[model samples]
Target chain A: MKKIFLSLIFLAILTTGASAQVKMLSLPQLQKRISNPDTVYVVNFWATWCKPCIEELPYFEKLQATYKSQPLKVLLISMDFESKLPAVKTFARTHKLASEVYLAQRKSDQELIDAINKDWSGALPGTLIVNGKKGIRKFQEQEFTYDELNKLYQTNK
Target chain B: MKKLVLLMLIAVSSMAFKLADGGYKVGDTAADFKLKNVNGKTVSLADYKAAKGYIVVFTCNHCPYAKAYESRIMDLDKKYSAKGYPVIAISPNDPVAEPADSFEKMQELASKKGYTFPYLIDETQDITRAYGAKATPHVYVLQKTAAGNVVKYIGAIDDDTENTKADKVKYVEGAVNALLSGKQPQVTATKAIGCSIKWKKSA
Candidate 1:
């Protein structure tokens, strides 16, 4: 009974550790992730403190689940300061989000914002959908619903 | 011919929306506004008869980014109020959309922080819309010229948000200083990661 209990605790810790890995991405690294011709990447720029971003996050998760079998990736890139990484990790863990979570590593916000889309004004809840092969890059600096996300993904396809 | 005219009308309206979305650019004349201050007084940029310019900042109470820059913004008012470039902060958040940014909260924050400048509420949000303010702590430096308040600069207050750097560029200060010295700011605009201005439901 003691062995079984100890192993269960160990298994829980292992799973938690695996899921706690939040990748740090700079502009170039982020660009590389979406460059794959076979995969469609939906990169969402958000922060833990942004209410609107938090509200619409579940929609992205739903979109990811609905397209799980497809060559699509949903990346939630946090715009929170790097010092707030612990808070971001806690948020992702507590929320149990399935999308790939990343912390943006940039020297300046302009570098990342302008690189992604010139139309973007470095606001929270911004999303970018990119398909390298299709040569499609759509960006919206606003919150999205599940149906809207799905429709945008479809239209882009 | 009827279809073409209808299409032209549609195009014109859509173009107006687009123009509204892209707020005030540098060198453009900014319109003055009558907004209620935290002190329960109706204030306008035109009310400051002795002022030469204004450091109009669109900021709010709850945003983490705004909270981080609160002290810095106060310092801007302190250093420039005597110089005629007083900081006039405007809370542009919709109270319905963001309850923490209501007028009461704005007054609470102003008193708690002991703000030196007038912290005003853009009640109608028409001023915010006209200014094209999109983010909290968005800075717009205007110079009182013969034509009117000419926007000298727009964008971030500085280069670093974390406030950890010793050599960070102070964009707002530079603009205000340049205008004081009868010179144009070398750096006119910048971008920073900020909380979006909470628009009312219809907006």
Candidate 2:
């Protein structure tokens, strides 16, 4: 009976971990998520080499937390190399990120740039807030204050 | 959500790079502006005139990203300037906040590196803004004409970071070649990879 109970507990734990696994989506899936009818999304394009992007990530998390009551979601899309996915995954795991995470799969900078925004001049820490009613508001750079974020949220609401 | 916040803080402390802009066209006349160079001499778009083309690059002293392209910038001038495409570099950061990017240090670095081009300083940070220069080592390639000098390309020096890869695509070189051959560059604008320009937050 002890052996059976232990096996059952192990199985339960495995299943739970599997269910909670983070999904890294492709561009198509990412676009679908962005275009989803009900889910308001905040998509941020960042890289590990960029200082400002790293500095402002915490604020994005705070913004995500503040909107937990709503159907809003935060997506962090890393522009790191595809080969660095392991490193990125380990980094994400180490950081304990709960928000949805993705690695942009575009090989060329042009492709990635077009994927984010046509007008973007390849600036780091770019952010896009998409809402059903408000459409999309994109910030080309970082250094956003909490009040500015809140104002964006408030206006969208 | 709270978990996410904790995670972001941890993530930030671990990594240093930031995302740069991508997906833009090139081949437009650059906006004219004047900025001080490292020698304390004011340089402007009108200063360097080439019958064929010119190169305007926004660079800084301390950024690792800028450091990566230092040699390349020198090479660009050495290779092309005599070919009627002189490269002009500008420092867009404030002297107070980033002392390494000051005019004095710029001269020191340029002299040490034996830079063949004019290294200028944008003291007011206005010219940097006018060009929408967001990062260190940002490049704008231009061509001179009877009408005026027109911007031919704007983007990274090459697709390689630290210049060590077979997969690297030399964007600036390709563009310059295209212009030399009197043909439009296959790609005008490219995504820049470097450090963000440290702009002062207004009081």
Candidate 3:
């Protein structure tokens, strides 16, 4: 019984340690994952500190579930620090989100800022809707409903 | 009838150049607003009536673009305030949404950076909307004339995006110099690119 309890404690600590580190996404890795010709990629820029981002997260989850069979990929890219990777994973697990979660690990904000959009002013709670073939549309805001999200997809398409 | 329709389309397209509703025009008397400054004291635009003009900048704490212009803005205030164009910086971001842009934190930054100008906070964001400010580091140069306060120039601080060295044009500074020389501003408005000011969510 003591051995089993020790193993359980070890597992708990292991998960906790894993949760704290942020997963950084390289540009090449991002390009590779999102380069699918069939999918319309919805890349959301969010952080735990942002309330509006938290509020609108469930809508993205719902959108993902609704279009699971479709060629739609919802990628939730957390702008949180690398050290907060574990906490972000916990947040994702707690919220029961099915969308692909990524930690955008850039050394400087400017690096990601220029990569996303030349016009991007580096605001949180931003989003990038990429057709992967046509073009990209970026938004800087806190809250957006499922209807708004749908409208963006339709208009872009 | 086709000619008339084309004329109407052209006229409608030109109308986009004018200020939006409730926005400050070239000759509108700017309404006075009391905002908490970096010093923890209230500062108003009217208080600078002693000056010939004002360099009103809407900026925030968290935006990287805002940070880029921090020193340049200070320098502009320092150089121009002596020449009668004082700079008044306002932060329009909601404190609850952006804690770094809160009043107390603004005060701290101003103190630490030794800001020569008033870094004001638009608590309700009314001042921001009045100026039609869309991004951080957005600039509006107003010259107090016998007629009223005339907006001389409204746009980006300079031509550089992220690199200060890349700045080839000084739009606001140039307009201020022209105003100081009693000449009409050459460029009235240009597109401003920066972080969008965060407005408070309706309860």
Identify the candidate with maximal lDDT. Answer: 1
Mark the regions of model 1 whose C-alpha exceeds 4 Å error after superposition: A1-18, B1-18
DockQ of all candidates, in order?
0.74, 0.23, 0.10
Clashes of each: 0, 17, 5
**What are the per-residue Cα lDDT tens digits for candidate 2 across B60-109?**
78877788798888898889887878888888888787778878899999
Tens digits of lDDT, candidate 1, B6-123: 9999999998777666779998899898899999999899998889999999999989999999999999999999999999999999999899999999999899989999999998
All candidates: interface RMSD: 0.8, 2.4, 6.8
The full ranking of all candidates by lDDT, starting with the best, is 1, 3, 2
* lDDT tens digits by residue: candidate 1, A1-157: 9999999999998686536568788889999888898998999999998889999999988888888999999999999888888888989888887788999999899888989998887879899999889999989988888888888899886
- Tens digits of per-residue lDDT, candidate 2, A4-97, equal 9999999996555422233456777777778864767778877766666777777777888888988788888886656667767776665666
TM-score of each predicted structure versus truth: 0.92, 0.76, 0.60
Error of 1 at A15 (Å): 1.4
Model 3: residues with Cα > 4 Å off, grouped in runs: A1-147, A154-157, B1-22, B25-28, B164-167
Q: Output the TM-score of candidate 3.
A: 0.60
Better of 2 and 3 by DockQ: 2
Candidate ordering by DockQ (highest first): 1, 2, 3
Please give the CA lDDT of all the candidate structures. Answer: 0.90, 0.73, 0.77
* Candidate 2 positional error at A41, Å: 0.9
Q: Please give the lDDT score for candidate 1.
A: 0.90
- Screening candidate 1 with a backbone cut-off below 3 angstroms (N, C-alpha, C), the clashing residue pairs are none
